[model samples]
Target chain A: MSTIDVNGTAVEVDEEGYLVDLGSWTPEIGTALAKGDDCELTDNHWEVINFLREYYEEYQIAPAVRVLTKAIGKKLGKDKGNSKYLYELFPYGPAKQACKYAGLPKPTGCV
Target chain B: MSDVKKFLYVNRKQPYGTIYALESLEVVLIGAAFEQDVSLAFVDDGVYQLTKGQDPSGIGMKNFSPTYTALGDYDINKIYVEKESLEARGLTIDDLQHLTWEDEDEDWAEKDSIRVVSASEMAEIMDQQDIVLSF
Candidate 1:
């Protein structure tokens, strides 16, 4: 475990950079995490991150990438649902990277 | 002949009391990716896993009851709950969440995924599985 400073507030994070305490997440923390990877959080990115947070809130688990793709298609339209689109948003794997920003555990069944 | 094998996961433990329930759920989700014939059985204390309005926050455990609803999305639609188990615990089908899946071929028509069965019927179903894993 380590701590990441989000504007002077240190929050605990796991080795993989996932928030150790999910409740510690804020939009700032998310932005900081994205910044650490040299990636900017665009509205399109926030769309998926926010969706993951909401999905975790309702299902209590981060969805597998396949499930995420289908669900995104259902909610965000087919253009934004495919893995190609999701990969473009979170190139380091949609379920893993987006879930980390969303303060969720690595998706169940994610390799 | 189709190469798919019938797999039955037998869950008999209460959620959060042990790791078996969560482990079973994870395995089910992973195994579903293989496109095999998979089904789940809830008997004994396992019925509690499906009870609705579960809030494990006070217990410091993730409330995974909601995850059961995702099983339908994984194409694991055949969920068997033993009737005797529910009666012994003072729970009826109404106490559980209504889980369903959409049939794509049927124009996304929603269909129920849970089936309450007698203990004897559960045994008959178990007998038909190519693989039966108990937890």
Candidate 2:
């Protein structure tokens, strides 16, 4: 376990940098997480991050990349749903990197 | 279809108080990528997994019951709930969450994923599977 400072408060995260307690997540923490990777959270990035948060709220499990892509196409738009679009937003891997910023555990079946 | 094997996941435990139910769901999601013909059987105490309004927050555990609703998006639509198990637990089909999938072959018509089956019918389903994974 490791800690990241969010607004002077230490937040516990796993070795993989995922939040140890999901409820501790906040938009500021998400921005801090993205900054650690030197990736800035733009409106585009926040869109996917917010989507992931809502997805987790309803399903209680982070979706695998394939499922996430298809679902994004349905809820967002086809133009923004493809892996190319998502990958461009998070070069490290859409489900992995985006889920990290969204404070969701690594997506199920990701590995 | 010749290359696709029929896989059956037999769940016989309660949703909580054990890890089997959660492990089974994870396996099913991972296995869905293989595009096999998959079916889930909820027998014995497993019937409790599908019951509606599961609140595990009180137990300090993640409430994963809602994750079952995502099964439809994974193309796993064949969910069989044992009639005997539900009756033994004093639950009816209405007590479970309603799950459905879109039928692409039928112009994307939404179809129910859960089917209540008798023990004998469930046995027949098991006999038809090429692979049976117990959880």
Error of 2 at A59 (Å): 0.7
Model 1 chain A lowest lDDT segment of ten = A102-111
Q: For candidate 2, give the DockQ.
A: 0.72
> Over the full model, what C-alpha lDDT does candidate 1 score relative to the true structure?
0.91
Q: What TM-score did chain B of candidate 2 earn?
A: 0.98
Query: Each candidate: what lDDT?
Result: 0.91, 0.92
Q: How well does model 2 score by local distance difference test?
A: 0.92
Q: List the residue pairs that clash in candidate 2.
A: none
In lDDT terms, which candidate is top? 2
DockQ of 1: 0.70
Candidate 1 docking quality: incorrect, acceptable, medium or high:
medium
Q: Where's the lowest-lDDT run of ten residues in candidate 1 chain B?
A: B67-76
